[model samples]
Target: MDPMHRMEQLVTELNQHNYQYYTMDQPQISDKEYDLLYDELVTLEQESGMVLPDSPTQRVGGELLKGFTPHRHLSSLWSLDKAQNIEQLRNWNTRVLKLVNDYNTKNPDNPLPEPGYVIELKFDGLTLNLTYTNGELVQASTRGNGTVGEGILAQVRTIKSVPLKIPYTGGTIEVQGEGIMNLSVLNRYNETAAEPLKNARNAAAGALRNLNPKTTAERRLNAYFYNVGYSDDIQFANHQEMMDFLRENRFKVNPSITYFREFDDVMEQLAAIQESRGQLDYLIDGAVIKITDLRTREALGYTDKFPRWAVAYKFEAEETTTVLNSVVWNVGRTGKVTPLARVEPVELAGVTVQNCTLNNVGDIERKNLKFALGTRVFIRRSNDVIPEILGKVTEESDGEEIVFPEQCPACGFPLEQRGAHLFCNNKLACKPQTVARISHFASRDAMDIETFSEKTAIQLYDELNVREPADLYTLQFDDLVKLERFGEKKANNLIAALEQSKDRDLASFLYSLGIPNTGKSTTRMLADHYRDLHAIMNATAEELVELPDVGGIVAESIVTFFADPFTQAAIEKMLNLGVKAQAPEAPAAVVEDSFFSGKTVVLTGTLHQLTREEATQRLEALGAKVSGSVSKKTDLVIAGEKAGSKLTKAHDLGIPTIEDEDELVRLLNQQG
Candidate 1:
């Protein structure tokens, strides 16, 4: 075959496979197979001294440029207004409705239809603007200052999902989308990486903004096209039509786009998406809600900075950058010494994060943060967890070194390094460790000893030498009454609470033991599986690893915790002091013939008679799958007072609803 002809055929075939694998999530060929063809094409291009402009091999990246050139966007990329809460979203909707109504009253003949909405995921990545002229990709840049941006055509071309040449050849057009580094890709990269990238957002943004195109290609980034900001030969009637056009031209459009006729339904879907945010492969900080009709959007027009027709409903931010001020080593209940970084006060996920966890010395080294003090670092807080310092801003650090402690801060014991962590083996002597263990044992999730506080633990430890959880069961009323702020009533109440905690279930008792590497879920699973405390204590690491979500580390931790002589003596002492440690009865089988059996049910708003939690439990008892939002798949909706978007959506979708309190009560009673 002629080299040119074969090259064309190879480019077409390889590009098709790339589209199928990356954009469509379906791979028709294996990686080895794809590589053989790619290598052949590379050889042919080199031999022939000719390369096609649209060749898949172009994504390999070219020479490093000195600097980026300024590229003025054909049409300004406007920012969307943000809504932090549902009320803010509702207010934006009200304003959009008023604008449409006002326009309709002015122009009666060609008035816009009732305003509908299109929902898209607000991707947490760098915004990219690509311009194509005569069907060929000519330029790509960031969404800088809305109008002008730094040109990054070479960097954008390296993204295999981006189309090199489009079928539309009538005129020039500019498409807008997000350039993202998928979470899975980031993980894989970090596994072999010497200095790991902090987050996906920063990885994508930094790669694109880099002067070296090879660095961008090495990240193996991806793009998802969403809008045609400027088009000379085409016009879209609505968002759906524009999306269809993008799809037809081989653009990588995200499949999660949905159209809704009612604004309330949009809100419901946004809430639903937010609840399942973890399921996505990429990071999405929010959802974008836009007017579906082009006419309505045009009528609403733009503000000084944002478009009035669209708003981004921002979810709680999970990640942000902050400066690390200092590092403090603290002893945990297990006598493990961990580094806690005190960062510059920054707002993250609605909380002021001043302190972040560094995990251990191994993590600090792996993240290239051994000398990251007094430098900017990316901090992350998710699901209300304590913030974690991911890494430094740059691979090479100019900051001061974070010195690992040679001795325990509290007990002044020589620290021992054990698997990336420092430990103070003086468990009985360390005051902080002992105090933490006692407090954790009496916590609400553990023994549920009411009116107990950390302050109480401190006082007991300082005055009465309450060293271990077993000591709590041995405490006398006279001892407590002699402590500061412990009146007769308070002392009596403490004794009564301690006595009541003796009957706690085996799961709670196990959690209160402060077993290493075990959480509530793991303890609960162990309790359910064994049904006896002795069985769990005697189980080997090999046997424990068979349980769900249990790994080698957790299994070994559990076995080691039980093997200790001190732990065995503590358990025996507690048992002798009237601690029952009873296991719960096996759960009853789910009712298969109830009204809510095998159904998807949604509960919305405030139930005057029963709390939402109580209603959810009742529904689940009848074998219903409780969901956060309403959709066509929803079998029934229990709408209470002030039920807003979810109830409205259920009604719109023609799903059955129980709005009356009496009807809801009757159904729940019937199930029982």
Candidate 2:
């Protein structure tokens, strides 16, 4: 067969596989075989200079939408609180228990009874709202910004599971459902399409959001109705019965639905879901557990957002298989050469994955990984997180002998082994090191140069004699244009980006300085402590380390950076070029005895009273440290409605918990 014919055949097969996997829950080819065909197609297209419009390569990402328009939801849509572990689930139980106890105590004569809980798989997909009038589907909308959603009724009508008309003759009712494409369906759809979908969620989201309804219908999108948002003359006794009614009416309900009579039973059900998650045809990150009694639910009520009665207990990522093609070493900005595995692509959770980090040399040796090409390996995204190689050599053989390089690939310098890391000592001279360092300095968390990307930084270094980040401010428009692909229009854009970067706040600038271990939060702490760049530079290592979140390593890096005369001179040059390296004034004085004053708080679950941003602000204003996740260092877990895994973890770790919005408000009032 000719190359062109072979290429065409490959594309057709891959597209078919994608469609089958993504749109329909069926797959005909192994992941390894699929990857081989995909890689071949990519190579052929690159070599032949022929491009297909509907190709799988288009799914990585595309140009950002110009702007989003207001989309009023047919019913109010809300987000669920996430519980990532067993501990969070337990905390949620505890909170519910407290609420029940409190209510029972208050109304002793007409006391509410403990309610059973319903557990269902929380599909990791887009939330959609469907409106019905007189039992007929009228409109469908994406959950855009809660209050408004994009009108996609036409697109929604195409989904098989989404009924165009209700089966029951009923009054006006609003339905909430998860618009999802199964992994098998997504893969099959991608295989059959001109281009494969990136992931099931993205595929479903993109399809639902498409301008044409016919295109969405062709993808065979499906929905699992979960909730009755609003209803008149159609009431259910509990959430479980409501789901049953929905299923009885031919609405697709998540099959994993189970009922637990006790909190321990809920935990057991959650465990069962986690164990069976991998075996299921569809993807589910967590289990949604809700109170099964409607009367109890009414008493529990709601906060600003989310029902107080429900929580999602998320399962961490599970381990699976793939073929390791090769191991590549990467040098980070910190001069650590880390081992990365390039693997045959496989779908984990909902994402199509190919590469994962192997950590360091010790990790590789510890696992006794067979460094042979095409070795099957166990792979898992940590907590359904960033891809990582767990172990290797499923079927052992005389594997290809693998060895770490003694010299840096980017710069031919002798590599030094420290602990598990291989480092290039020639940090100043190495092109990759320089580019990476400069890129780090310009990152949003770092100095935050708005338009400076790794690619652009590489271009400047290679073509314009731009080595250090400081050299960026020194470049003239004429010199920028001299670089390959740097036309007049592009040059002007770069200059504009550079100009805008000068006015960034002190904390961002400090973080951008590429100090070791000084992330955005730490940088802010240091900035607040010193109040000026000069003070930070002059502070002793001990003084620097005394600040919140700053450690010995970070302090040492800051001291070293300031101690270097060359670095100081570079800063002077930057200052001369009009870079404002000063910290912004602190916000208005917070109440000294505010509710969260001096508390180290960890927020977990869905908050009704405030947004995450608002909660963080409120905590910070009251002299509290609000962390992203739960840890031993956390003083309190301010759990709102539907608290998840973090709450459970906090409970196991013996952390104090506050229940309800009113309780939290009262705590704040007392502190004040």
Candidate 3:
């Protein structure tokens, strides 16, 4: 096939899949299949020396520029005046109508017609202005400081959802839109990350501002174009018609947008969106209602900051004021100490909020938050979100200033300070630590203990003198019954779970050990090298350092953990309790000379016909080092459907890549 023909076919297929997975939430092709096609296109482009302007290969992320260059809009972009409620919205309409009536009286001969409103969901995201010349996407900029914005044309191109060329053939056009992160994608990203992101707004902002096009591509950021900023030769009678024209030309229009003949219709739509906010995949903080008639909008004119033709009905502030009664310290897994503020029960947003996070010591000091026996404070929650403390009391009182404890509240041991964090020194003796560790040990990724739960472990710990995880094996039915929540049946079930954990593979058992800086991936690496817990414990630091992916810090942490007498005792006890800690039979070896041999492979996105574990095992058999994330040393990334930011990084680094499982297989087979 000709390069142009092939390019067109590839783009169509890729765009179709993008719409399926991103917009429609239904993906037809497996990630691996999509990658196969993508890789072919990339290879063809390189071999033929033909780079199509709209090729997907052209969009890869790179480092952010030293700074953003400002670009002024041809037509001034304006903000919208805010209305919080129905009455406020009605008042705005009335005020606008009165102005229109006054302007008509001055003319006397021609009276303005009743204006229609264009109501659309006000997407909670960063606003972007896109300029297209002769149907080619030209300039993309952020709404920086209102007047001018940082130019992000390079970054914007990487976003697959942002069309490189508009569907229309010819026009000089400017469109207003929101660059947003879909809620589902945001949640999925958070779930896979070591530290989950705070919210969608921040994620979207971070993605858009990224200097690398590859990074933007991984984020799967989507755009919805709403308004025509400046256009010539295209005439629309109303705002609705303009939106229809944009949509017809393959521009993504906000699906929640509604045309209202009467103000009551606008109010109804707004109410519907508000009530169904949770059902929608993206966050909508409010609704934007505008005069639909283009002539009416022009007559309404502008304010200094906002367009007089439109009003944003902001969601009512879901915040309430309350008093801070006390602040308490809580310990978490990984041993980070956090402070929680206990405030008087106050209705905020839609729920009653009694507590808010104080984060770390820095937050407390910065807020200068004083929670004596009783202190006045304010709390705010919007859209069923977690309530936050807005501020604290203005007046000073006789109550003592709250101090962070120097010792673990649960174990009464002195704490260790590392950077900004304070941690309990009692690694095993701390009740919270013990419970958390045991729970982690029995998690599906760790020991795979089918029946053990945190609740059951806590019950055994507090009531039955089950001080350590090893003690779980000795638990009796009567001992469980002595606890408040557990009955005879539950006790037996827990014992069964303990028995099942004994047969888990060495890697999971090692992970279940809960050594500092040791996670599931690292645990697997150690197991693959040493074969058993006994071998790992007996291995010297030098021997441990030789393992793939085990760095100096990780090696040191492992050595420290094994050298500890308490940890040694715990392991001895666990062995005595009949917990098996040995690797299963290694998979049949693939050809040693395969490209995967000794090379680090990072897998992202959904794989077809192979589970993640299966793929990892296959790569390991070929002597490859399979890893969880992309780093400087990653040799190849096997990208699949909805492949993330790591895939983009791999491309930017010019790393060798395989698009699909079949291609991966073929490469290995070639080496064989």
Best by TM-score: 1
Q: How accurate is candidate 2 locally (lDDT)?
A: 0.74
TM-score of each: 0.69, 0.51, 0.54
For model 1, how does the per-residue alpha-carbon lDDT over 1-672 read when each residue is reduced to its tens digit? 888999999999998998777776557798999999999999999999999999998897899999999999999999889998999999999999888888989999989899889999999999999999999999999999989999999999999989998889989999999999987799789777876889999899999999889999999998988999999979999999999999899888876788999877887899777765654667889999999988788889999999999999999878889999999999988899999999999998778999999888878889988888889998887645688888887777789999999999999999999988899999988999999999999998899899999899999999998999899888999999998899999999999999999999998899999888888768877987899999999999999999977999999999999999999999999999999997866667778888889999998878999877568767777888787766556788988886766775565345788999888888778853
Off by over 4 Å in 1: 1-108, 112-124, 130-174, 182-192, 209-225, 230-234, 240-292, 298-324, 343-353, 363-401, 586-672
**Which of the two candidates, 1 or 3, achieves a greater lDDT against the reference?**
1
Which lDDT values do the candidates have, in the order given? 0.88, 0.74, 0.76
Candidate 3 lDDT, tens digit per residue, 477-496? 67677677667887678778
What's the C-alpha lDDT at position 92 in model 2?
A: 76
- Superposed on all Cα atoms, model 3 deviates from the true structure by an RMSD in Å of 12.6
For residue 38, give model 1's deviation from the true position in Å. Answer: 13
If the candidates were sorted by their lDDT against the true structure, best first, what order would they fall in?
A: 1, 3, 2
Cand. 3 TM to true fold? 0.54
Q: Regarding TM-score, does 1 or 2 come out ahead?
A: 1
Q: Model 3 scores what on Cα lDDT? A: 0.76
